[model samples]
Target: MNVLLFGASGMIGQGVLRECLLDDRVESVVAVVRKPLGFTHPKLREVVHEDFTDFSSLAGEFKAVDACFFCLGISSARKSEEEYRRITYDYTLAAARALPSNPSLTFTYVSGEGTDSTESGRSMWARVKGRTENDLLAMPFHAYMFRPGYIQPLHGATSRTRAYRLLYVGVSWLYPLLRRVIPKHVTTTENLGRAMLAVAGAGGAGEHILYSPEINRLAAEGR
Candidate 1:
């Protein structure tokens, strides 16, 4: 399976990329990045894109992919709702539009847990993610939205927030204990990444794959 990835430089993206690289089923990986990925592999191709809002120039590159894992995300630091929506909505739509050319495209989006697409106007981040999720679900291609909570990294912390870093370190040893008590809503970055790869290689049964505990359970069995 040929996979296209966006935001291959971010925390979750890095983990997902690693999983894709290791998987034998993945024939090739095309990364669309703002900066050069500086890696040489027979199955890897880096497409340096200048603008995220427009992919017209890179249409050909986006056309032949079997599946796409869009991990491009920004933190809700101090940005206003408009700025956040632009990044989360506008950018996602632009990239998703290219999937039509590859009719059997499976789109796996990295979405948060609290997202609500009813336009409830509650939390700005959730509302935005909800809207994005709603829109993507309406698209023609197959779509899967992963809503993971407290993603424990496979390696060192990558978040700039000191609180997140400390939490990662603290939970590094207690993950097994927490998994027994906590619901499967909380998952490791490794598991989530592998799940995405599985969905991409094996076409999801329906138009949308809303990954919850059951989906993760199935993914674990295959691994």
Candidate 2:
């Protein structure tokens, strides 16, 4: 299987990229990044794309991929709704439109836990993500929106945001306890990556969207 990935430098993207490399069933992995990740592997390929909103220049590279793991996300922070929407909705949709709309392609989008499907919510980020998820679902590929809450980065997957990194560091030891107690919402990066791979290889649990619990369950198939 050939896999296409976005946001390969981010927290979740790193994990997905790692799993794609480790999985023997996968033949190749392509990551579209703004800069090189300072890594090399026979099965790995990187395309430096400066503009996320315009993918027409790299149309050829998006072809013949069995799956795409799109983790290009950012905290809304103090930015205006338009700024957040540009990155969350516009950028994601550009990539989605660039990809082939085939049955063999499974597109896994990393939406957060509190995404507002109604697209008219109190939260700015949630509203944008919700609209993005809804639009992607309307696409032709076998798409799955992965809504993971409180992901514990594993196998060297680190967050680009300093606060998030510190938070993970502070609570790293509590992960085992958290997983056991609130298993439905919290999932490890390892499991998230494996789950997406499983979905690309085989049909998922008869569901287009997957929460943390379902992700963990599907990831177990790899083990």
Candidate 3:
């Protein structure tokens, strides 16, 4: 299967990209990024794109793509709602629109756990993500939304954001305990990637929105 990946440099994206490369089922991976990934893989292809709002020039890259892992996202910490919406809603929709209108194609978007599908929520990021999810589901392709919480970065995968990195480092020692105590709400980057592949391979069947428990189940089933 040919896979199209976005946000390949991010923490979650890195894990997903690693799994795609390791899995023999995946033939090739095309990663869209603003800068080079600085590494080479036999099955990996990097496409540098500066403008996230427009993906018209990358239309050819989506051709014959069986699955697309849209992991692009940003923290809404201090940014205004407008800035967050631009990256959260606008960029995601642009990519979804750019893909071929093939019903067989699987498009998995990485959203957080508390994302509001109502599109009217107290949280700005959740509202924008909710709208993005709603719009993508309405598209022709087979789409699924992933809502993972407390993802443990495995195999050296680290977040690009400094605050996240620090948090992960501080919490790394407690992840095992957390996992045992709250298995349903916790998952690893490895499992997340595997789950995405599993859903895509299943032709986007089952639940449209997956949480950590469901994600882990899918990963195990895929294995």
Task: Name model 2 segments beyond 4 Å from true.
Answer: 203-205
Q: Which candidate is the best by lDDT?
A: 3
Alpha-carbon deviation at 79 in model 1, angstroms: 1.7
Candidate 3 clashes between residue pairs 3 or more apart in a chain or in different chains? none
Residue 139 C-alpha lDDT in model 1:
84
Q: For candidate 3, lDDT tens digit of each residue in 18-53?
A: 999999999999999999999999999999999999
Consecutive 10-residue window with the lowest summed lDDT within model 3? 196-205
lDDT of each: 0.78, 0.90, 0.93
Clashing pairs in 1: none
When sorted by lDDT, best at the front, the candidate numbers are: 3, 2, 1
lDDT for position 188 in model 1: 66
| Per-model C-alpha RMSD | 2.1, 1.2, 0.8
Model 2 scores a C-alpha lDDT of 0.90
Per-residue C-alpha lDDT of model 2 across residues 1-223, encoded as one tens digit per residue = 9899999999999998898899998999999999999999999999999999999988788887889999889989988999999999999999999997686688899998999999998998998999999999888888899999989999899999998899999999998899889988899888889999988877544577789988999899678
lDDT of 3: 0.93
Candidate 2 positional error at 169, Å: 0.9
